[model samples]
Each structure stands twice: as C-alpha cells, then as structure tokens.
Target: MLNRKIATSTAAVALLLTWSAGLTPAHAAPSSPAPTAAGWLARQLVDGERLETVVDQVPYPDQGATADAVLAFAAAGVAQDNATKATDWLARPQTLAAYLGDGTTESYAGAHAKLALVAQVQGRDPRSFGGVDLISRLTALQAPSGRFSDKSAYGDYSNGITQSLAVIALERHGTAPEAAVDYLVDAACQDGGFPLYLEQTPCASDADTTGYAAQALLASGRQAEAARALEWLEGVQGPGGGFRGSGPTPQENANSTGLAAQALRVGGRTAAADKAVAFLKSLQVGCGDAARAGAIAYDATGFDQGNATRATTQGITGIVGVGLLELSAHGEATAPASDCPITTTTTTTTTTAVPATTTTAGTSTSSEPAAAAPVTSNGTRQLARTGFEPGPALALGVLLIATGVLALLLARPRRAER
Candidate 1:
C-alpha cells in the first residue's frame, strides 16, 4: 500500500509538469503567406500619422507655420502633381529648413528626413524637395573620423542612426553613396554590432544600432557587410525569439525584433528573416489599442513603434524598408505623377528707415518705400488627413502588455528561505 501511494504521487507530479510545459506560450508562428511590401506598408502607417500628430501637439514658436507647410506639402503630394506639391513645399522651405540650419542636431535632421520621405513617396524629384540640402547638412554633421556626431562636439560619436538616415538621403539624391557606406563601416565596432554612439566607455552593441547599420549597408549596395551584421544580431536573440535593447533589460522587445528581422531580410538571410517574421507576427497588436490603431506596437511600451515619435518612426522605417509591415489602408490613394515640372520664381525685398539719432546735423532725413512683396501660391493642403482606427491599437496593446508581463515574471528571482 505504501509503495502504491508513493507511485501515484510521483505520477501526478509528472503529469502536472508535462501539462505546464505544453501550456507555455509558443513562438509566434508566421502568418499566412509572407507579407508583401505593400501589405507591410499598409500595416506601418501609424508612424507617419503619429509623427504628424505629435509634432502638432508640440509648442514650438514656429509650430503653426511649419505644421501648415508640412501638411500642405503632404496633402499636395497626394492630391496634385508631385512637381506642384514639391514647388509648394519648396516655396516655404525656409520654414522647415530653419530646423536644418547651423547648430541643428539629430532630431532636426531626422524630422527633415521624414518629411523628405513623404515627398519621395508622393513622387517629387529628390533634388527639388530639399533632399540636396539635407545631404549637405548631414555631410557636415559627419566628423572627420567618419562618425556622425551626437552633437557638434566630437566626443560623442554614435553614428549608426544618423548614418542610416544619411544613407537614405544620399540614395535619394543619387549621390554620396560611397561616403554614406564609408560612414557606416567606420561606425561598426569589433563585435560586428554598433553602439548608440562611439564613446570610450564599454557598452554592448545593441539591436537598434545594429538594425540601423544593417539597413544603411543594404541601401548602399553592400549586402555582404549587412549580412555580417545580421549574423552578429543572431547572437543577441533572447529565449523567445525577441531582442533586448541592451544588457539591463532582457525582455523580448517587439520593435527591436521587428527591426532586426527587417535588417536580416534586407541582408538576404532567409533563415533569420523567417525567425524575425515569426517574432513580429506574434507581437502584432489588434486595431483598437490606445496608442496606435492598426499598427505594430514598438515593444511592451503599449505605444505603436512607427508613429510620429522619433524612436518609433525609425523602427517603423526599418521594418517598412525590410517589407515586414504596412501603412494604414484608409488614406486617399492617388496615382504617381507622370511628369515632373521645373518652375522657378524669384523676388527681391528692401526696406529703409531714418536714423533715430542725429549724430550728423548736416545729414538729410531720407524715406524709402518697401520693395514689392513676393507673390506665392497658397500651395496644397490635405483635404482630409488619415486617422487611426481603434481596433488595431487595442490588439497591439494587448500583445505588448502580455509579453512585457511575461518577460518581467521570467526575469524575477525566487525567494530563498532559511
């Protein structure tokens, strides 16, 4: 009888263990046939809308004018001919260009790049849409050592993200591909990964930095280098096929994994690409989530990765470039322009004022009328901007929260008692 009771207890314990193992969350299986670029694009539209919405909320002194101009350009690109839209944006380019002027930083460059991309998609000539100016600014930002700067100071050299954007801009203009490639190569660390910036301090190469580097290399036609970077990334994948931002947090991050998958795909590594695709599919939030509707959540942040927020936008771009996500489906779809026109107009303005003080008693007071004001078009504005639906955001939020909680629980330590 005693032997039989012991056997029964052991059997029950074994059965429970087996059931628990089977109940563990499985890796996200790939959804259907692989998602196409257009499909992925449709999934990733939140980043663009989010960007516009965030910028709209900020209280910059020039916010109104800049927003007006950007929205106009974006709307015109969809409604009017690409050239006409480009002309409208370029006419008031100074509004946004001010952000790119001297003492400008990464955020400015990134904002302009995002705007440029919108113009690109709208079929504007890269040169006419301020792409050339952006290239010049980014080039100047590059240090002599080939690293992009965190600021004007050469001390902080985290060139991966900046270099990635520069590569996009360079490719757009059909110039400086070699320079962009060289910048990416120089920023690479010994471990085949990249750091946020180049510092003397010891820091592990990160998924975000590596993802940007991989994308840049791929864009510049250096598939081999991009492939090597992807190999390095494979080493960093966590237990459940998600990626960590760095050492402190081992959580499986949706955004990082999505971006990593994109890089791998673009680098031409099908095996890793498949894993990344699976991971992203698992993290997809449904359309009703709070932060973003109908888009992939960035991580457990409950925020859509690609919307107007800076980090999210970069992540979205990476994913989109790799063909894993798509933009929203509701926006107006216009045909690409057949012809790009060249239109130029110039105006001169002058003002004269009498001296407030009479240092010279003999000097005569002179009055002059202001020169003729420049004539300009009202430019294109969005008849209706796209809005996010609730279902996608809710679904993405649910996934993000669930995964984040799981990661936290897994990371927790069990108590030891005396």
Candidate 2:
C-alpha cells in the first residue's frame, strides 16, 4: 500500500507538470531590430501624418523631418501606410508652399531636390508634385559651375547634402546632367571624402557629406571616386563602429554613424557594415520600458526624448543595412517589438514549478514573477509617448514679415532640422 501511494503521487506530479506546460502562454517573439525601431518611430509621428517642429511657442509643419521619416519608413521596409500618409501630407499645396516656396522669390535647391526624392520613393510624380515641376525647378537652380544653388535673394545655402540629393534625384528621374556629376566629383576633399559646405576653406571632409556624396557618385556611375570616398569613411570609423561629423572635437552620434554605415554597406564593406549595425544596435533601448523599447538612443549617454526622433530615424537605416538610394517600403504594416533579453520568473502554487518563458516588453531579469501587463489583441504594447514630434530636418523661426526667410534658411539646410 505504501508503494502504491508513492506511485500515485509520482503520477499526479507528472500530470500536473504536463497540464502546466499546456497552460503556459506563448510569449510574443521579438521583432528584428530594423522593424522594431521603425515600429516605434511610426508611433512617434503626430496623428500618423507629420512631425512638427516648434519655434517660439508656435508649431509649423516640418517638411524636412517629415521627409526623413518617410525615407526611414521606406528603408525599414515597414510602415508603408505611415509613409503614404506622410508623402500625401507633403504633397499638400499649403505644405509645399511652405517648403519649396511659390516658384518665385523663394525656390530652394535643397528643398526641391529632397522633396523630389521623397516623391519618387512614394511612387508619386516628382514632375507634378503639389502642382509644381520639381525637376525643371531643381534643374533651373543649377549654376553654370554645375552646383545647385538657391535662386533666391536670401543667398545660396546649398551644400553637399543638397548637391548630392539633386544629383540622385535627377539620376533617378532619368539622366543626371554631366555638369552636375562633374561638380559633385570635383567637390571631393584631398582626403577623398566630400565636404558638407563646398565653399568651406581647406575642404574639410565630414562623414555626413561623404556618405551622401558616395551614394550620389555611385548613382552617377563614378565608381572610382565613390570607392575613394568610401575608403576615407573606413578610416574615420570609430573603434566601436560609430562615426561623428567632421569637427575640431567630434563625438560619435547616431546621425553621422547612420549615414556612414549606409555608405559603407553600399560600398560593399560587409565586415565594416556589420560592425556598424552592431554599434547602432548597442544604442537601441532593448528592455525595461515598454514604449521606448525599440527606440535607438543618440549615443552612449542614453536615450533622450528631445533628440530621439532624428537619432532613431537615421539610425534604423544602419540597423537594417540600407542606404537612402536603395530604400523602399515592402513589408507588413504591423510594428514588431524588439527581441529583448529573456526574463525568467518563478511562480509558486500548490507545487514549486517554474512557469514557461513569456514575452515582456523591455528587458528584465527579476526572479520574482511580474504581474501581467495589459496588451492589445495583436500584442503591441500601447505607447505612452505623446506630444509634438521633433525632427532635425529644418530650422526656421516663424515670422510673417519674411515668409521667404524659411526658403532662404533652407538653402543651407541641416540633416537634423525638423
């Protein structure tokens, strides 16, 4: 009888273990880093339409930032709907008026070039964007020297960013002008990298300018020059694989690192590219916070909401190993959570049995069982992030006295202005 009782207890325990296994919830699988970041970024958009920049307690539509967001969406191969909405918002007449000017007194070479690329990526006709001829307008701004200049009284702020953009846009449209291609090639610094400001003395090379210039060169069939530029980039890459802009005291940041990584990958530097992706992933918010999980921080200092928009937007390209020229949207619309480190917890019931692993937003390693967090039906954690999204794509103070001032400032645009 004693033996029989012992056997019965063993059988009960086995049955309980089997039953518990069946009851264990299937944890959500974490998404790849690219989609993970892209998903979080898609949520950051205000009303899923645009990103707004505030100046002097006022909000204006940030077309530059919005354009970057579209490119980010396309590069990640996710968030096609959001990309479409953003492009549509950009194509709005009022929005175009604010960004590209009314064809007279305020046409920006950089704005036209950047928006033309954005329109092309969205499968929209750049020729007829917002009832404006982007191609002709952009070409019209090209000087005799082949540099695309801002044809406005405010002065020319066109730099390598705008020039590279113009070349790529024109190349994609059909054929890049010979003069434009030559101008881009001639702008290469002595170090084989390109300068952000072509007019800057000594022709100091920076990662941001070199990255775009390399891509533009490749697009224009200048393989030899592009190779030289990529070589220079390989030299400037930080030991940890991050890159900083060209400056007296450059500190590694996501924006420059992101663009450099894109160029390296396109230049066929696989080993270097992998290192860059790893470096970018290191900056990603892996676990702990549900809402900020997939967001990539600006640097080692950690994630800051104020700077996260540009950081994540540019950073995802490197994470996914795509360049601006090769970006497109063709994946599922659903945003996936990042694959965070697994957290194991034990639950005590009638028997001291360990529960199956479950998916939790953010990384945690607490031994104590965590209470269940609310999840949507499809399993995405609801975002707690809110308010106007900032982008570093455009910077302009609002003033009616000089509406054209926006275009003038746009001539010399920054990649991070929003």
Please, what are the lDDT tens digits per residue for candidate 2 over residues 102-195?
7888899999999999988888899999898999999999999999988677788899989999998998899889999999999998999999
Q: Give the per-residue lDDT digits (tens) of candidate 1, residues 29-69.
A: 11211221112322322323211233445533332223222
For model 2, what is the C-alpha lDDT against the true structure?
0.74
Candidate 1 residues lying further than 4 Å off, grouped into runs, are 1-99, 102-121, 130-132, 150-158, 175-180, 247-250, 287-293, 301-418
Q: What is the TM-score of each candidate against the true structure?
A: 0.51, 0.75
Q: In angstroms, how far off is 319's CA in candidate 1?
A: 5.8
lDDT of model 2, residue 68: 86
Give model 1 RMSD, 1 decimal: 27.2
Top TM-score prediction, candidate number: 2
Stretches of candidate 2 off by over 4 Å are 1-31, 247-249, 337-418
